[model samples]
Target chain A: MTTRVLVAKVGLDGHDRGIKVVARILRDAGMEVVYTGLFQTPEMVAVAAIQEDVDVVGLSMLSGAHLTLAPLVVAALRERGSDIPVVVGGIVPGNDVEDLTAAGVAAIFGPGASAEEIVTAITTLVPQGH
Target chain B: MTDNPYKTWREAFDAAPTRDADFTTLSGIPLEPVYGPEEGEFPGAYPYTRGIHASMYRSKLWTMRMFAGFGTAVDTNARFREIIAAGGTGLSTAFDMPTLLGLDSDDPMSLGEVGRCGVAIDSLADVRDLFAGIDLSRITTSMTINSPAAVMLALFVAQAEERGVKRSALGGTLQNDILKEYQAQKEFVFPPRQSMRLVRDTMAFTAAEMPKWNSISVSGYHIREAGSTAAEELAFTLANGFAYVELAREAGLTIDDVAPRLSFFFNAHIDFFEEIAKYRAARRVWATWTRGHYGAEDPRSWQLRFHTQTAGVSLTAQQPEVNIARTAIEALAGVLGGTQSLHTNSMDEAIALPTARAARIALRTQQVLAYETNVAHVADPLGGSWFVEELTSEVERQAEEILAEILDKGRGSMLEGCIAGIEENWFQGRIADSAYALEKTFNAGRRIVVGVNAFTEGNEEEDLAILRITNADEKKQVERLAAVRQARHAARVEAALATLKRQAADPTINLMPALIDAAKAEATVGEMMGAMVTVFGRHVEVPSL
Candidate 1:
């Protein structure tokens, strides 16, 4: 079984280092990755995920706009009838991680997360057959 | 061999191998056992392992450039005055996102972003207002805008002209680095090739007219903040700088003609020694490349003068005040590393655009360092330190290897296809791995960041007032943009824009004159950018990973 992930940057956050790094790690780990460049709208991210048929959508946002952007991407994905899991990593505050989780984010990786852990999380969150 | 005084060095060391936990780089380069003169050379020489100039910060302190912008032009003008009044020696302008993206405030695309991040400038009128009472002759200003940098440059030139300031008398920097916008910032309007053309035009124009002005500030601040490793930041930025120099040369400007005006902007990350080494290595590499590779004879052309910004990524939202400490440490590294100018990040940066109070504190960080601290009393204070010199040499060596790898692929080929390839392979991948590794370390309790995964107690809600631009301010900005558009003569704007479009399509013609004409004719940023975008289509990054 192969894993496909769409790594995206949403909103005005121009920081792509985390997302770009994650995308590369996932690819090297034998998963297909799609990198959505900076300033992506939630709708664009969800559409890209659906069109690419990715297994999971990972969001990397450092800008304070994550409060508005993260939830919108999740909601947009669900509304588009894609039940793919979502993962987020960045400078998100500790208190807000739970908020992101409650918004249907499968997992939240903060500043200190490793690529192996993220790959493991995605592989575990979505079963092979699913 | 076993009976040697060191007990066969490895054998004796192996018996204990006292793992010096304190001696490792963020990238895991181990500290050497010892260093002699042969290990790394002296300061102010090739490889610049120690320092760029013989007397560094002791000769002149780093330029105290506070990043200032907010609300209307008048409001931001007042803030600039406040920063200057508060002992800032240089000025750095932060334009609102709309201006940065070449959109007028009234544009539908600019909704909710006008005057939020920085100041809003619609035309030369706004530029005039921005520098209304400010003297351009005495103090230098750095503008941090890229895509519409040529337009802003025109506006600036016109503003200075209005004040009877000769182009020759003007001094400052324009962050005319559009390539980074594509690679990191995403504020780019035209595609890469056309953006390079605009940069070439600006370089040619400034070289001829405004000799005192730094045409392009080749920036690695955004690249580092975007998550590049220190080595990646150093190599990629120099590569981009080399590309710009090549562009200027292709535009018929001599290497010496433009190299002196080329400045750099770097991010001073939390890795204190590593960041310091990065700066030293940067100057050495830039100087070497300018003199040896580009054959630049002028000493001024060989020097790498940069402005430093404390790493915004190092700041955490949990304990925002802790950022002040982080910024101070980073700023110190920059100062010791010998930056020409510096902009310290605000403590509240992780949460919002810095409030006035936060901005003041940020500025004061530099002030205290400049006056109160004895750190600036001597030049390149750490120039001869064994540890610093060793680290600087190691960084330069590693960075040179990376540069070789980048160039081995052929500079032109790399510029053509390797950019996307590298974005896929090394650039984005390495960033991901580092970010992931750091996260894993935190989660596993190996790495501890205060107020984060570990030492996570005593986090409390504090009553803090954040300065926010109201919807009313946004409304006023939009109205102002609309009024500027309405007031400008329609036919003149059209004709000027048409001329710009025609000139933009030609490789031989410099677009700066046409852009200046358009700016003077009161064509708003979006109108000019939109016109050029028509000639040069919008860039869409093709995802390779």
Candidate 2:
């Protein structure tokens, strides 16, 4: 089985550099990558993740809205009866990272996290479960 | 041979050599060991390759305009006072994410974003609180806004009027360069043509009424952040600036009237000399185009005065304190390269919003460069350097090529060309390619960013004091917005919005007066923008190649 990942940018934030980079890395890692482009709502991301049956969902935010957006994404995934692990990356503060982790985000990639680390973390978390 | 005398040194160098190849700037501009007059033109002269002003900082230091905003208007107002009190010269305002996107704090879209990134201002009341104790006439302000720049400017003018300050007395630069938003920042609200119309309306109105206010700050800061090469930043920014000039002329404003009010904003990145050369090249290119192409007679129209913020994209979360050194170097480049104003990034920006202490440190970084470094004592100190001049020429050559390409796309009309290119996603695609290339280099260890790639410290992020906006702040902001909505006369707000919608529908009418009226009626930012969106419709990029 190959790993399947969904990359989504929630809300009105348009900082897509990090998310786009991650999508490329996942695709290069031989995973099936589905990119939800900018200005996506929580429900949109949730529906796409469920429909794609992704093993993991990755969210990227640079606007400091992870505290609000991450939980909504997690809850949306749950409401759709999906158990896909969630990972996030961007300029998220440490406190927010803790909060996001507590809110069921499986992993957080900060500014210095390498593509290898992110890919490894995803592979470890999902383990080719798609 | 004469080289036989130094044969031993050469042999040693060959054995333990440099890592790879010859040194070059981040933009891949080849540098020389020395610079001379053979490189280009002189400072404070036509085709200003050196300095725009002959004396440069010797006559007056560049303005220490730090971008301060966060939490409520009152909070940012207090921060502004603190910055002024700490020997800062001018003010630059940063709006919250919600406000930047033209949403009111009470809107569902604005739920968790209020007061997170910058100060939240939903109405003129918030603007009034933002400048509560400060005298508008005493200090100049530069707002980092687009899409709704006219609304923000109107709010400023209305607040100034409440303070009995004449509209002409206020001074500031509006980041009304929406073309760059489509290219880089991606904080766009309306379609390209409609947004350009709004920009043109503001330019025409400001040219007539607000003589001291800069109607547009043609920006390259976001372009650089969006992963463009230095030359690409220069080319795209100047292309957009020319498009605006063309757009204003199409709207029937003379070049002399609106040209002087057009300012620029740039990014002072980690490459010290390249950043300096980028500024020098920018001045030369603008002067050449404005005088030769637009036939501008005024020196102000030919001069390229810009405000620079040290690159936030260059900062790293690992060993965040090292960012202080990075900022100092970048700020020095802005000074040496001749900027009108500078903002150094806070050390903690890579992690979160700067705490007050971090903000002060950022300001002190500028002060140290201005007063202690003594680099400002001479005008274009590196004017005749072989390396600097060569880099400057290379930047100019590359930028002019891009500019020519953009103009060619316009089919003789730069504005049309910009519109066509934006709709075709040319600029966005170019930036994305550049960004991808840089990321590849970084990931492959070809480019060594100090704390990120080269000098790897394992999980070095310690206890960092990052600014956090609590849930209480959001609740308070929402309630305040609710109270404002309840307090303002509903009929007046509706009437003002209706007039805005009417004006928006009619391209013949300038929308500034109606926007100002809407601001005065206490209409929220979202309401005014919502009305316009209803008239002009909203826009979203496809982001596909």
Candidate 3:
């Protein structure tokens, strides 16, 4: 099966250039990328990820709310009996990377993460059985 | 023709003393020792193709308004003082995303976002704390708030009242441009027409009451940051400005009375010559439109004064320190283009909120340009350059074409046209398309980003320490909001909000007085904006891309 990824913008941050670019990148990389538009709450994202049945979910946040909001998205998926890992990206500080990983975020892509690296990370998140 | 007055000067320049050094650039393109045809309209004249002022920086340096706000009121207040003490001329406040969207700190939507991107302002109490020690009367402050900018302005006026500062004595700007919100920033709350009402109300209020305050910093900074070309940034900003002028005319304000106080905000992107050309074209377009189209009599009304912020999008995540060089080059472009004020992005802006040390260096970048370098001695110093003049005219032509397209959509009403465009994702579609194309170019290695593509020699690990604003600030901000709510008289707040809602529904009444009354009652930004929301429903964007 082809890799499926759910891309979303959680919370009130509206810097969508990176997310939009990454969405196109994933699509170009031969992956089915479902993008849930802006102002999505964690619950909405989790529900969308589950409904889409994607292999991984990507959250783009630049409002410095990643630490508080990203983990909640991860937990929201688990609460819904879904283990769909959420990948995070944006202006994330270096120190918070580990905390985000420990919170079950599959991967973190900072500002300069190349298209190849992002595609690889999403690809690796896909299970072979899928 | 007429002996070509420049012939003598050209011949003298050709026979001028030649240096032994090669005039060719590193790329091997030969450069003329001197450029000719250095004749054009002077600065401070009609059309303002050169600088808006005759002397430009020779008379007064561009105000350095460093945008620094994060965490609680007290936290941001300290940073404000640091900026002030560091010789920053003006204060520019950056509200948190929640604050920008007009949500209370305790609102569920504002969770994890309070004081994150900027300061968390809830009520007048928070504003009081935010500007506690800062002199409201003497210092000019620019608040980067929109969607709920009228509410923010009301809160500002109420705070100024508390400080016993006369409303007319106030000097500052409100980023009250809402058209770009739908087009780019996406920080909008109410629908377009309703938001225009709020903007018109604020413009009318400032026109009548505050002489020094710029009612709207009609902005293209966010538009360019959202990946618009420099020309698009100029044209969109000017078109929106013209829209506001139309709205003001309908609101019974004279063009001259309102136009002089209407300033602009633009982005100085990394396309150095192109960015400079964009500014020159912007002034020419705005001046021509205000005079020829709007029939403004005052020269100040024709002059376009703008604040330039170095493009934040151009900063790189790889070899973050390299951003300083980019910022310096960009700032030089802004200065050369005759910006009225400037904000240099910090080296670590791509990673996080600027560290104090990093912000100081950014400020120093401006200081170096102003004091150390002699770039400011002449106004519109690059005006006569053959290349610059050509680029300016070309950018203006492109911008004017798009602007005309938008104008036709509203039957010449920019406000209506903007609303129509927002309804159908016209601006959004174009912006998204441009962004996608640029990303493709970068991805395909067609363009070179120093650290990201061409020269990737930096460490994988980012070692630069960044300023962190944790949820502790959120907790404190929420607690403060709660305390403000508890302390203020609830009945007064409700009554003021009711009046505000009543006034919002009425087309004849200006909403600023009611908004100011609500602010006086200690009504929160959410409550005031909530009242407007009740009158004008929320905006659900037409999803483009």
Could you say which candidate leads in TM-score? 3
Proportion of true inter-chain contacts also present in candidate 2: 0.57
DockQ of each: 0.23, 0.56, 0.69
> How many clashing residue pairs, candidate 2?
5
- TM-scores of the candidates in the order shown: 0.83, 0.93, 0.93
Candidate 3 Cα outliers beyond 4 Å, as residue runs:
B1-39
lDDT of 3 at B359: 94
Compute the lDDT of residue B234 as modeled in candidate 1. 90
Per-residue lDDT tens digits of candidate 2, residues A1-130?
Answer: 8888989888778777677677777888898898887778888999999999889999989887888998999999998888888998998877677788899999999897887899899999975434
Global lDDT scores for all candidate models: 0.77, 0.85, 0.87
Put down candidate 1 lDDT per residue, B93-115, tens digits, no spaces: 98887788787887755555677
Span of ten consecutive residues with least summed lDDT in model 2 chain B: B1-10
Native-referenced DockQ of model 2 = 0.56
Show model 2 residue runs off by greater than 4 Å.
Answer: B1-41, B457-461
CAPRI category for model 3: medium
Between the candidate structures 1 and 3, which one is better when assessed by TM-score?
A: 3
Superior candidate under DockQ, 1 versus 3: 3
